[model samples]
Target: MTSNAVSIKQIMTTEVLTVHPGDTMEQVHLVFRSSDIHHLPVVDEEGRVVGIISKSDYYSISNAFPLFRPDLRAAANDRLFKSLLVEDVMTRQVATLTPEDSISIAAGYFKENLFHAIPIVDKGGMLVGILTTFDLLNYFFNQEVFLPT
Candidate 1:
């Protein structure tokens, strides 16, 4: 099927890893470091997508407060980093697509924007999945059967 024919549900990753608005920056840092994905959808208490956090954001803040090798200094730095909330740094205005959106729509987004990821939401505006340029590339290069027209 062409990209226009294939819905985002077919390619979007449903196993979304999300953070809450009140989550500590240090927790966001750990998630980014451990996960292979670069972008995180920030959700509210009700699990609705509220914002987005990129690896770049994490690095930008964490790097500015680098921990010293000394235990005392490292502890102090760690405390400072942990005190910041994800809401303080996450992008409040996020671009999102519904599960019904087609791959063609996602392609258009990637083409026109600098951001690499888009959160997928359900009809109720609840977080459902995430789509990234990597997903698009993987679909085009590895899954040739679904190549766009």
Candidate 2:
């Protein structure tokens, strides 16, 4: 490996918000609506990563339900969101990496799969952090030291 080869640990966000399988979509919606984050990793009580929920996943499923239509009454959307569980909409097949994994590896996955975010887990399969495409860009540009526009 190169002397300066960056690893996922160097750029991953350690503090992350998560949801559980039984949590309602309404809770997920609230998190998405209230924050600027694009992804939420789903974890069990033991902190093991089980699935993932992306903003796109939420919106895509929203459209799948008739009541979530913007034209429909707000109250209906509220009720529907409350009724659906995170397990119902979250992607069961999740890809993850460890903090020690190289950024090159993560970049390859992001490029090939077009994933916006990838959760980072420990050896025990516990959620630890998240690596996002934006984080990669930030690290890349910082390394380049772009001048003011």
Which one wins on TM-score?
2
Worst ten in a row by lDDT for model 2:
65-74
lDDT of 2 by residue, 1-149 (tens): 33148889989999999999999999999999899999999999999999999999888866665655566656666787999999998888999999999999998899999889999999999999999999988887776356455
Model 2's TM-score against the true structure: 0.89
Model 1 agreement with the true structure over 37-117: per-residue lDDT tens digits: 899999998989999999998778766645565766567658866899989999999989998999999999989987899
Instruction: Give the Cα lDDT of each candidate.
Output: 0.88, 0.89
Instruction: lDDT for model 1, please.
Output: 0.88
Counting clashing residue pairs in each candidate, in order, gives: 0, 0
Best-matching candidate per lDDT: 2
Query: Candidate 1: minimum summed lDDT over ten consecutive residues — where?
Result: 62-71
Clashing pairs in 2: none
Runs with alpha carbons beyond 4 Å of true place in candidate 2 = 1-4, 64-71, 145-149
